[model samples]
Target: MATILVDLDGTLLPLDAWNPVFAEICKAIAERAGAPPDEVWRRAREKNLILMRRLDWRAFDWQQLFDAVAEELGAGRAPSVLEVLDKHLPRFRPTDGALEALRELRAMGHRVEIATNGHASYQLPVIRRLGLDEIVDGVRTSDAYRCPKTCPQYFQDADLMVGDNPIFDVYFPKRFGLLAIFYGDWEREAAEHSRRLAISIDAVRPDHVVKNLKELPDAVRRVLALR
Candidate 1:
């Protein structure tokens, strides 16, 4: 049986839509802090990117980041900000064909696993809510190891369990000898993102490039046939 590793954020769930959900949470945070909504959004977004860019994932906690943003706006508003975020958890909906694709992969005898760069506390609940637990055999999150997917060790661990590795940062997974499946809408976009991120997707090249999850099973089968 082939073990299939999948990404959660844009790959399984539709994060593009979820950005507004986050934005709403930020807006609420800003309102509670008594700061102009735009100012709060600007500060939080800037801080978020800075924290995400850190090589050490443990250096920041997203909840703490929200709290700090609230503090920067002024104290006595952290609780309200957290409440706003907690309420928006239900906004994380998977893409249109995601669940159907997961079912097909399982029915076809693939050992599906979620290999994601999110915190387990956040990722697992969304997976469960989307009913992905029914299809996936297991899940790996960056929070578990206190490292992001950019770390080769995270990929090494995933490669040990699943033969199918979804390419997020190609160089990281390639270093661990996993077959890369570049999941994106456009080859040009994928290529550019890989280059800017300092990852080498071209060297391994992706075994497949899928625009949607519905195309994944056939892509997996083709790769397996070649093997």
Candidate 2:
């Protein structure tokens, strides 16, 4: 069976699904330090960006962000990363049409797996919470792979890759010779956002472009047919 490697965040799940959970973590950290949660959270986001710049974007570890924010807040007590994540995972749901696509693809005898750039502690739980494990063959993470999806070796066996990230999910996978699908509505991205970025999404082309998860099944089928 051919392997279909799909990105987790922003593909199987919404990108900002962790917002409320991160808020709760920040709130708890602030309470320990007698500081405002919103201010602490804002600073945490800034700290996260700074840290992210120092490492490969795909190798980003949320635990590192949590530790940085906790240290800055002078938190007397902080919940463990796993503790915070356990509560957070419940907030996630599979993206629209993601579940159906996975099921149909697997029923078609394709091997479906998640290839994500994330910390496994939280990422794995989120997959389970979203019921993705029901149809998924397995999952791989940057943490386990020691490299971002930008590296072709991240998935040497993937015949097809799908995700919202044009750079990592679509462009890189195509370089690795996988049939690619650029999912999500890229047109909604602000012009100013592109102007500020070093490289625009338009620069990284995929074999197929899909506007939503609901379009993914057909896109995948069409790509497979051509192969």
lDDT on C-alpha atoms for all candidate structures: 0.65, 0.76
Candidate 2, residues 132-164, lDDT tens digits: the string is: 887899998887877778676787888999887
The superposed Cα distance between candidate 2 and the true structure at residue 165, in angstroms, equals: 1.6
Checking candidate 1 for backbone clashes, the offending pairs are none
Clashing pairs in 2: none
In lDDT terms, how accurate is model 1?
A: 0.65
Give per-residue CA lDDT, model 1, range 5-40, as digits (tens): 778877788766456646776777777876777787
